[model samples]
Target: MDIAVTLEGLGQGFIYVVIGILFIWLVKKIDDWRTRDFDDDVHIDDGNIAVGLRRSGLYLGVAIALSGALGGSSKGFFLDLSHLLIDGFIITLFMFSSRFINDFIMLGNINNDQECVKSFVQPDGRKVVGNTAVGMVEAGMYVATGFILNGSISGSGGTFVQSIVSAILFFILGQLALLIVGFLYELITPFNVKNEIKSNNLAAGIGLGGILIALGIILMSSISGPFTGWANDLTSFGIYAVYGILMLLIFRIVIDKLLLPTTDIATEVKEDRNVAALIVVVSAINAVAIIIAFSM
Candidate 1:
């Protein structure tokens, strides 16, 4: 075994374990407080916001640690890690920032009491997003990091300048896909109506779905021909990434919308059954889609 690789793996694994524990703990804390503060309603306090950041940090750390552990030297770790961390931070920032601004601006027409800011759900069944602006921001970190890392935007071989260019191209293409989906979701929002609460679950779902699908599509698009010549490989990888993101986002939605308020704080609820089933079906469809895409 390569001693350097072994040591690096050990270090990364240690960091991952630490980050995972912190992540679970922070999520639990956020869930507990969210249950108490915004259980039936959605107005989360600023303190809950701090808990959100903790969760985000946990995710960022975990992603970097895991990425590092996967047969890479420490030389590129900081650069790759920084890219992962900053990208995660930026995504989270934009997600929550968009929510806050949208909510605040629409406050007059739509009752400010509706609590739109805190309705974001992190992957691990946490209600941090629905309690405070911070929760969404925190959750956004995870989503952003997940997208950037899973999209094949890192560790490509090139000179410093070339690598920088590749990274930017990767990020820009992903964001461009996101923009297209965002616009599409916004346009389709009028078609899906659930309640008088001014919240559109279908639209939200579509937006989340768009992110995953677009990420897959754009990653494949970015890898075509001379760009990377790895279109086939990335598409195969993207099949999994898209499925994972969808499953994660679906859980996030369920926690934010369904299970949390309905469950009693006295008892613990594991995965929501309906949401789990939905994820299974969606994942299956994504898998099938991937097979078909590759076959053609």
Candidate 2:
């Protein structure tokens, strides 16, 4: 039994490593594409491929360790990890794939001189990134919830159906919260607004935000349901949705009233307050979701 479990861990670890490598490759390709100018003559440095590999390896190691820790928690842990990895990987691939579509659909018509439009790409891109990240996280939660509902690690049709419904509902609510905060941020934060407007680096910032969103989703999803189950079992905690919403509202007010007021936006134009707000709110929501998921 011990040998089988160890072999399973190794197998799962290899799978995660492979998925991480693919993401690394996609990130590199996007970086290269973004840096290339309209003039094919412009030289582009791909940057340290070795360094990239090393960083990805580090992340992979962390993920593997996390998986091991989770698996050791119970018989259901391995099954949950499998679901999380599969769903997370699938959603991430889809999210990145959509970037290509967006690049073509949104920016296909502009001439080389108009390449400054790349900056516009970020504001929009961040939304996609944020949305995708949330989706992935929700997927992970549903996977765990499914196990809980069925009282087993093996997937079930009834549990899966309910989980899918729950995930969709939760995802929509999450996105709505993110979008509202993003809009508010645009209105209040001079720094965020200026960066959104006249800044020429929108797409780059959006890419970063999107990646972070994905990371947040993965982290949150991995533990919310089980944590909630544990908490409920121990303390009968409840009201998770309300707690998440309240946390978001509090954070939104703080960012809008305090941080935005400090920024001097007198000189900046057309800043994307929405994206900025979205960042703070999504981050808060992600954090709170984990808390509630575990607590209830």
Candidate 3:
């Protein structure tokens, strides 16, 4: 590669990082507004560091993913500055919308609740304040939405109208996939996920959140290339949906039967707040996601 091209790429990457930081700050402000009573600056008292960190992670991950997509689609290492900034803005809007959707699913409203800021009792009897578990789930949703949108935007290579339609279709498909995953999670557990997370069950939150991110990673692999037409697009989505279901089944079998044969993973999460077990489950799902991401 030309030295100038390399320098330009690095410069654009730095710009993305700066924009991402600013975006995170705006997200924090919006979160504070939505939550209404929490103060992010005071970490020791009413502040939920875990929530903040998780949100930051999601923002940063999405920024990086979007940047990578832009880099890949560019003619060389360097991105068109106009396109970079434009797409960055678009992605930022998508992230905000995605957050709203997550809140709708998890909180049942666009506004945050005290339940999300409630404290939980750990296995060691420590009183941990803030619903970090909910944060985990939110993070997963944000990251997944980012990946899906990023892939969709990158894949759109036609006229503006066509691209818009394709992006919308892909986004809808991604949301449906998330819903199916959530349903499957509910089936595996005997308790209500929202209630469990609202009760400050970190284990349950992390387990559920990890599965969402893992599913998103797998779904990202399937989102590539321009849409041929509605028929082809629907057919491709159906195939990916089947693949996602199969992957979920395999994930369940591996976690429940192969990895933790002696442990009832769902029961552990629902009843015991087994953070360690949740970690193991999350790790397993992420391992599969990594393998799938790399293979693609």
Winning candidate number (TM-score): 3
The lDDT of model 1 is: 0.39
lDDT (Cα, 0-100) at 270 in candidate 1: 23
Report lDDT per candidate.
0.39, 0.36, 0.68
- Which segments of candidate 3 are over 4 A away from where they belong? 32-36, 44-47, 75-79, 106-112, 121-125, 293-296
Q: How accurate locally is residue 124 in candidate 1, as Cα lDDT from 0 to 100?
A: 52
What tens digits encode model 1's per-residue C-alpha lDDT throughout 69-146? Answer: 232334565664455444434333333343333234312244322343445455455554333322332233334434
lDDT value, candidate 2, whole model: 0.36
> Which residue runs of candidate 2 sit more than 4 Å off their true CA positions?
1-4, 19-90, 93-158, 164-169, 190-198, 201-223, 226-249, 252-296
- Best of the two (1, 3) by lDDT: 3
**Backbone clash tally (model 2):** 12
Each candidate: RMSD to true structure? 10.8, 10.6, 3.2
For candidate 2, the per-residue lDDT at 84 reads 53
